[model samples]
Target: MSLPVNIDEYSRLVVLDDNELQAQNVAVSVRERLQRLRGIYAYWLQFPSKFDKEIVDYDMKKFKVGRAQAYDDLHLTQILMGNLQQASKEFMRWKINRDLEEDLRLARQRGDLRAAASIEKNRIMNNRTDKDDEPELEFDKIVPQQFEMTDDPTVIGIQKVPGLRDRIRKLEKKYGDTKIEDADYEEIKEEHDGNGTGS
Candidate 1:
């Protein structure tokens, strides 16, 4: 005799996959598209008379909403901008921390005493920044991070370097751990002796 199969589970999966799941995915895609469109519209709206007929037509046709929706779009844009700013700041911080970590690992692997020390110090400072919940500059106020966009942009976040005293302290600690000769040590210190304005 053949055993009875639990056809209910199989039927549920097939039906959900074909219709409910597809509909949900489509709805999500539409929402995301609208969100992107709104952001683009808002960015252009930053300047007066920047809205061309094409943009207007796109909004009317794609969004299927009245021109009065600009008010809502503007409000949503402000919220989106604020979120984007926070996300960018967070991304920058993460990127700096990750880069320092990778640099430290590579320095150690290469036995580059001075480089390893400096990177370790930077990593420590990054950890401190995270723990301290450091305040970030306004998104637009920050200079763009120098990194390839194709790489891990989010993890390789942006950050301003710490002040001279802080950097010097870290450098001093890092230098103590290295086994460079006395002359080399002095040279390394000299090289790092810049007013702590560079990263």
Candidate 2:
């Protein structure tokens, strides 16, 4: 990169030459490749189980990319998709986008203005599809009918209030004890049940 630099008859060495420019171009190229791969990975995500040839073809055509690049992206996606055991709405969204993009790409490539416009319109309509189609979440649809929430201590206190005080009073009056707490074991009386559970 160190070539002759002449500035008004003054020549010196410079580290930045065509090589540096080429390096910058290389950086841009790598960045674009990564973005394309990421976009590809976002679609048809279920991997082997949900691998659709039409979907893959659509994505590749939409991306205006060769199958080699799509294959690379799919390989990487398969590795990353290992953890996704089930299909989700997110996947469906990506799948839809990929399909639309593919169709739009094909339309544009074929110079079919009408088809491209229609696809774009469909994409716009799809943006709000789930909004009217169904609830945002199953949990959001839970409309309780006279629902009541109580803490554990409050519930136990409420349930025991009616009988607890009366029982304590009866025990206190009967045994005449100050504590009125439960005994560990009842004395083995002569006419007790054989099970020993005091039943």
- Compared with the true structure, all predictions reach lDDT values of 0.53, 0.55
Per-residue CA lDDT of model 2 for 1-199, tens digit only, reads 1122223221111123446535655355444544554555555453534544454575578777655445544444444443242355558767888999999999999999999999988887766663565532222233434547854356555543557767978988988856867769867766558787555
Which of the numbered candidates is closest to the native, going by highest lDDT? 2
Candidate 1, RMSD to the unseen true structure: 37.2
Error of 2 at 32 (Å): 2.0
How many angstroms is residue 4 displaced in model 2 relative to the true structure, after the best TM-score fit? 37
The superposed Cα distance between candidate 1 and the true structure at residue 36, in angstroms, equals 16
Report the poorest 10 consecutive residues by lDDT, candidate 1: 1-10
Instruction: Give the winner by TM-score.
Output: 1
Looking at model 2, which ten-residue stretch has the lowest summed lDDT? Answer: 5-14
User: Which residue pairs in candidate 1 have backbone atoms (N, alpha carbon, C) closer than 3 angstroms, thus clashing?
Assistant: 91-157, 92-157, 92-158, 95-155, 95-156, 95-157
| Candidate 1 lDDT over residue span 1-199, tens digit each | 1122234432343224335545656455435434544545565556433433344455556666544343333334444334444455568779998888788789889989999888777777655744766674233332433545553334668554547567878899987676755563343333334676534
lDDT of 1 at 86: 45
* Candidate 2 global CA lDDT score: 0.55
